[model samples]
Target chain A: MGITKTQIFNEEQNDLAQFFKVLGHPARVAILQYVSNQNACICNDLVEEIGLAQATISQHLKELKSIGLLNGEIEGKKMCYCINVERWETIQNQLNNFFNKTKSNCC
Target chain B: MGITKTQIFNEEQNDLAQFFKVLGHPARVAILQYVSNQNACICNDLVEEIGLAQATISQHLKELKSIGLLNGEIEGKKMCYCINVERWETIQNQLNNFFNKTKSNCC
Candidate 1:
């Protein structure tokens, strides 16, 4: 959507849309799933796991980080990444609220 | 993502991503919320409610319908739309499963 279009909707709508937009890509979704499934922070393995180029994976990681869904730290030479649990739960609740409040009115 | 890139991910990942991609816009989210909030199916009120042009709203509606999130019918000269209850529940559960199964592995 255009920048001016976002002003019409409320904050919650824009926020939720941002989250959804970030996760709209399959690579991003795959990256989140792989990172979440790990027992420790992942570094330098996304390219192999997601079968994408390093640059592509980094771009996807950037998108995920932009939405606060990821936490990253430089461990010596590598940047390790993990899920941001608090943000994850908050997003989960927000989505749940959206689903719960919007009753189905099929005609 | 490119058409060829979608083949790299499994069906579930692709399907879920498609759902998120369709919902990435606030206008579509607002449309779903507005239609779901009503007791009856809505027809021709989206323009005033979402503050977008008729063509834009129609395009968004088309995207939502493509993902099976909405059901539309030609009612006289106007098209009425409502949430697809079964598809909605399925998507909600799919999202819940994705959130639940992907445990937080914050570093």
Candidate 2:
């Protein structure tokens, strides 16, 4: 949603929606997967691995970083990126709790 | 993407995108959280719980169910909805794998 429509939602709802919205792109997912598989901080290999332009990958990286899912540190002219383990665990726990609730009294 | 732009993306990417896209809405998130917090299948209480109209809640429910995240069972004039545990686990695993990759050589 744009700015106005989002005002109707509570803070938590908006935060959760913003998190999911950032994941709505496949390129982002692929980028996250690529980073996750590496098992170490990465620097500038997305263009070759993802078959996307440097600018596109950079944009996706920016989005992930904005959400605190991917952490980055500047080294020379390049930026090194890795998953934020604590944030990842928090997200995992939040989502797991949501899914773990079983149906006790369905319709 | 509407129709044509989606073609540029692979099948797995598109499927994952679809799943995240369905979750991009705050109303949907609220509904999911509500359902999860209930710990049971719920039918027709969304209007009261979510403060939305019946049509709006129904539309959101349909979107969630369409993505296979929520399962519904018919009972009389109502529909009882609960989380699809198997699919939820699959989604969790897929996302976990994506996040588990450590950055090997980021830019």
Candidate 3:
């Protein structure tokens, strides 16, 4: 296999790509949507809500948290999860800017 | 590895998941950004602009086209590409709705 040679890309390109890469998983998307729907911090219910195994959901949660999109607070033996609103708004604006910028350009 | 059994999820869940999955690749993200930046219909410059091999860029283009994010017009041996405005707006609204809905829900 040939090496990707990702070094040729700019940091902004790579950073933006990494952000999208985290969003690429179906399980993660479902988890995010579910969490978004929940609105309040959720604990122990993701497995039931998302229909994935606990391990799978946990892994997805970890990915979301890694991106700072989700936050968790330990309440006893369970961890309550909710969207980090500040990060959510940041991401939304970033995406909106990216998409809106496209509208002005044509070729 | 166990089978994912995606059949268990709702159609809306699956559709939304597929959209994000398509957005997950760095190459695809770069392609979208490049196309957005170009503003004019880009034909053969991608290999130069993004600095990926022809086949690699072609594969990435196919993925974006598959998702209806890009439109291509074949001119002789080359294909000119641009973002499809209507579909772009549709996807933007869908994503906006998904995120906005999350803000309204709790627990």
Q: Highest lDDT among the candidates is held by which one?
A: 1
Off by over 4 Å in 1: A1-4, B1-4
The predictions' CA RMSDs to the true structure, in order, are 1.8, 3.5, 2.5
Model 3: reference contacts kept, as a fraction:
0.53
List candidate 3 stretches off by more than 4 Å.
A1-5, A105-107, B2-4, B104-107
Judging by TM-score against the true structure, name the best candidate: 1
lDDT of 2 by residue, B14-93 (tens): 77777777888888887777776675564568888777778778888999989888888887777788877677778767
Model 3 lDDT tens row, B1-107: 75556687767666666677677666677788777777467556888877878998898888888889888998778788888888889988987887777654343
Order by TM-score, highest first = 1, 3, 2
Candidate 1, chain A: TM-score against the reference: 0.91
**TM-score per candidate:** 0.94, 0.76, 0.87
Instruction: Give Cα-based local distance difference scores for all models.
Output: 0.85, 0.73, 0.75
True contacts kept of 1: 0.74
**Tens digits of lDDT, candidate 2, A58-88:** 8889999998888898878877788777887
The candidate with the higher DockQ, 1 or 3, is: 1
Off by over 4 Å in 2: A1-9, A39-42, A102-107, B1-11, B37-42, B101-107
Best by DockQ: 1
CAPRI level of candidate 3? medium
Q: Order of all candidates by lDDT, from best down to worst?
A: 1, 3, 2
